[model samples]
Target: MSLVWGFLALLYVSTDGLEPVPVALLAAFFTIFGAGMNVRLERSLERKGEYRPSRKTLALAILAGAGFLAVLFTGVIPALSRPIIGSFYLGIAVAWATRLILLWRWEAKTKRRIYVEGTWVGSFYLVPPGPLQPAPA
Candidate 1:
């Protein structure tokens, strides 16, 4: 991750414009630094052994990351006007909405099991069912 950050920093700083390089370098450097932070976060989560995302959710996350990288590399965010940037953000919002719906459905359908006191508990819902309402009095 640091190597990737170094490469990006080198490329960005080597560009012709020196005036904004300092500010852009700081921003991009920290943003790239987040890749390393994400690794640390994933490791800590794995160690906890209590949280696991569904395969579908993981795949969607990968796709979303790839899509965002594609958008950035295509220069859509930098080259476009404000409305285009807004549209890009609008698309992200739509994607997030779809992801939320899919995640909720997946959670509602999937069951997880954990062992406690040498016995297995097989009923776990990521999205637990809502409380039942009494019949109309």
Candidate 2:
């Protein structure tokens, strides 16, 4: 991941030459950094018996990663804004999908069903079903 980001950074410097889209570049860096953090977090969770990667996780990872790549390479409704797309959009998408994959893995490991009953304002998680909690004004 670091290597990939490094290559991109080098390429960016060579091509754009002092471009002003710092946020987008930072997002790409963040995505790479976040991947390492995710690995460490999952290991810690496993040690705590809070989460475990399963086949479902593999499926989700493949699905999310491939979906993003498909959008990226296949150019299906591709982001025409070239600068923002590769750096900002892909970075955010991959990072977010990583988070979701972790959450889903945790739920799969814990036998917890996490979902909304309607609004997240009231009681939402539907496991061990009970009366819905009163909604806030």
Candidate 3:
């Protein structure tokens, strides 16, 4: 997640002295990865009417993507090794971090429990516990 990327970026910066292109590119990719996970979680919350990221949040994401795209194509980064693109990447990092903070808040906000099944999940119990059995050992 973001923390992992942040650690790697710290390593990279220690060696590279904040090379903007690598820093921005790595952070941008991490943002994308985390965002996808955020969206899926948000959708699950939506089913229970517990949460939905505001339209303003989506706009911020779009703006972040557009900013990165602009920097990606403008030749400023490759030609000048500009720190400006680093600012764009910082925006992405901060936005993703904010989304994560909101997610923690939503966990408390959920009115009832819900469930999700991932790729390997075959079955699960939806209702409450019936009885407790002692451990075999």
How displaced is residue 73 in candidate 3, in Å? 14
lDDT of 2 at 119: 21
lDDT assessment of candidate 2: 0.51
The TM-scores of all predictions, comma-separated, are 0.27, 0.36, 0.36
Checking candidate 3 for backbone clashes, the offending pairs are none
Candidate-wise lDDT, in order: 0.40, 0.51, 0.51
Distance (Å) between predicted and true CA of 27, model 3?
Answer: 13
Measured by TM-score, the strongest candidate is: 2
Write candidate 2's Cα lDDT for 8-114 as tens digits: 64454344333357545766676776677567555655455333345675577568756755665565643444444445434554565665576577656665444
- Give me the displacement of residue 118 in model 1, in angstroms: 25
Worst 10 residues of 3 by lDDT: 119-128
